[model samples]
Target: MRNPLNLKAPAAALAASLALLAACQSTETKQETTATTVPAETSKTDSAAGPKFLSQPLVKDIYTADPSAHVFDGKIYIYPSHDIETGMPENDKGDHFAMNDYHILSMDSVGGPVTDHGVALAVKDIPWAGRQLWAPDAAFKNGTYYLYFPVKDKQDVFRIGVATSKTPAGPFKAEATPIAGSFSIDPAVFTDTDGKSYMYFGGLWGGQLQRWQKGTYDANAPEKEPSGDVPALSARVGQLSADMKHFDGPVQDVKILDEAGKPLLASDTKRRFFEGSWMHKYNGKYYFSYSTGDTHLLVYAVGDKPTGPFTYKGVIMEPVQGWTTHHSIIEVKGKWYIFYHDTQLSGKTWLRNIKVTELKRKADGSIETIVP
Candidate 1:
């Protein structure tokens, strides 16, 4: 039996026939965060020997995946989803990826031990979300830290939600409803240098990118406006409200550009994004990084603005031992780092753990390939 969790197929597919017997089972709530009780074992530093964690899997207490990093309050905070083993029924005996909560890990300086700050958000708190908590991204607006995450709705389709807290390590309270018109997973928020905010969200098997249109998502109904390509394994982008709680304008399809600088429409599933959409702005350019699906390799492209017309660079990090590779890129105190997850620990693709490493770039503004 092929593993059903590898591609993060929409909850619609798994909720009915597969996940009920696997990770999405109702009994699995060991990781969910409650206002009075969060269930992760917190620790500071390396679990093995030396300070190996700074350059390796920093999250050792529990399984974590799809990391998103941010610099706030004089520290670097990483928001990652919690993965668990649900005794999946498959030939590979893979993980059900029963992730239902998130944790924020931080550090005061480079080479310092990463501190697991406990739970940031959880599926049980979201009024509209189901139990399938997945990849998440965080950002600060005004004075609040907003965590953008994805979960299956009552209908079993994936929907994005925004949760807020005053602190980075949060007991974040998800809004009473999801961001009006969002879908899919991995909601990446990019705040441009000009103070404008934008969000890029979606995933394979019907993820989408569109600004807040302020209405409930009707998967069976016609779109409020005709969209270019909102289905399949594609990424989308749009301006977001200052509060980071809503979409403000029309969202457009994210595209990789050719050498001649034109949008490559064929990028929907070829060489670009499979999932895990992350954006970093440096030297007046935008670096769009993603986990190339089916290949489990991390790749990136460059663009002039926050939303692309990005030009595909090359494969940044080669494939790892896992069947899926989801990640994020950030610079803390002038040092760049890539935060990703792998199955090297549990030796099961579904039971992923967080990994971090220094990201080096050449003089020409291109990144050197990483073997990790």
Candidate 2:
């Protein structure tokens, strides 16, 4: 049976689905002014004897994936997709990932207990959303917290949305509609050193990026990869308006090129951009990383500017035990960490759990590939 994108089931049916997801589910209570302790397990890795899992699932009660972690006010805040057990058969279109809401997670330090701030945002709360609340990101501006996410509108086209709250953990109120020109998934908002912010977004395959080849959405376009011989699709980057809600200008292509200055072709699945766009600055250079969806590897490229003609660097992570790999990198207290997910908790790709491990870089600033 095809899963309904809007999640507009009968009350009883919806309750049952929620019940199936209740194990690790957090409450839907009002937002709190102070952080509250939720049941979370600290890392089980022993430094003396290296373990196979760099770190255990930060969340076990409720499944979480595609972690977008950031350090704010001396604590780490994680914005992740809240996975659920939807029995719809898995497909390339990600039908089984029928998540309708999001839960924000936080911790004071690495290896410390995590806290799940329940139901920061939900489908029913957003006026324009249809379903499949995929991976999301968070940013702290002047004094408010902004949450950027991708959801299919009532028309079933993916578009980016924004919600806001005074606290990092939110019972957020969403804007009536999505960002005007935004179309596609995995919205990563990167604030540069000069205090300007840019949003990088796009995804291929079921992400419906191929439909936007002419820079506008074409619903009739086929949902398939481009010809292997052609240059692969590029992700997009646009400067955020001063309000942090809209785009200041039209988005430009973020091209990842080979060492020989050639654009990666669709046939080069191992290196071409797929879904999961992330940007972080290291040593004054912009590092753009993403998941090679079908290839299952997390790779990166580097450029001098935020909107880049980046040169492919190398793999950041080998394939994890999952069909898809999505991630984020952040520096905390002089050390860097990578937050990603796999199906270790449930052994099912759609129902995944997020994990974190320290990241190491060579003296020349190149990242050491993580063999998770």
Candidate 3:
């Protein structure tokens, strides 16, 4: 974790100042600061409160969930879905997964201010996307950055699409159509050591419950994500084109296994993948991580290749403090960090904000469970 530096005051000095403010400043000034403070702008600063709290909640100005982090040109860049208020008055019927756009945030070093590079893509720019634009992931290939996002079609079926830009923080333009053969949502893309890129996605437990039950992602499927939906919630991964705009190979349904190489039983409650699939390669070992159902914890499996015949591992993180937790893991300057979301600002589960914590792995490459 990046330690806070350059502050002129100590912890005691900050406490004394707050105490002095209480004694001398008008009550109105404090109320105004608290109410007017935007989360994105405020969270960038570290305080005398110390290290454990240093590199957390990367932005606070707006609700940013499903953080997708990447490193390019020696800077860490984040592509997170923008969460905002929605319903009919807020939504047609108060729908909750009502995200509309993406914002790119980047930092030169740890414990530094993350500058919002502005809107990278928006629903208004997608010709066929429904109003709800959900979790998104991005990749840098050749000289262009490709954004992979999940959006509901006009018919309400979930589909994944790509957007391209020459710069990392971009005014990314969406492709004319989504990648063919993509059916579910939550698209996460990973680029390997050999320059081969793969996309991982699917979360039937939350959206498409009935259609998922019907055993496919077709029209006339379930209207919303099924409650505690289990059964066949297998995630899919496929190699991407060199341009990163389309899938270039056969997409494979990830059939999770035990360390023994046997398929996970439906009864194995502890090792099922519910949603939020993130793939990264560490030390030649492929780590496939994802959030568990109910959205409070994340777990993973490992394999030797990019398209994994992965074996189930234990939990990576638990107690993320929100109804749902979406995350991404990236190694920044030799330090591994896991980025996820929780409702610290709005105090409402629907409005999750982003947070980051340094992640530790055992000598054998398994991650130690993180209780965030």
Alpha-carbon runs more than 4 Å astray in model 3: 1-55, 87-94, 209-216, 220-232
Q: Compare the candidates by TM-score and give the number of the best one.
A: 2
lDDT of each: 0.69, 0.85, 0.71
lDDT winner between 1 and 3, please give it: 3
Q: Which parts of model 1 have CA positions greater than 4 angstroms off?
A: 1-55, 90-95, 206-233, 260-270
Clashes of 2: 2
Error of 2 at 228 (Å): 1.7
* Model 3 poorest ten-residue lDDT run: 28-37
Measured by lDDT, the strongest candidate is 2
Model 2's TM-score against the true structure: 0.90
Q: Kindly list the per-residue Cα lDDT of model 1 for residues 218-295, writing each as its tens digit.
A: 455432223244433247788997777888976777877656765544234445465688898889989988876655
Candidate with better lDDT, 1 vs 2? 2
The CA lDDT at 3 in model 3 is: 14
Model 1, residue 10: displacement in angstroms?
32
Error of 2 at 88 (Å): 0.7
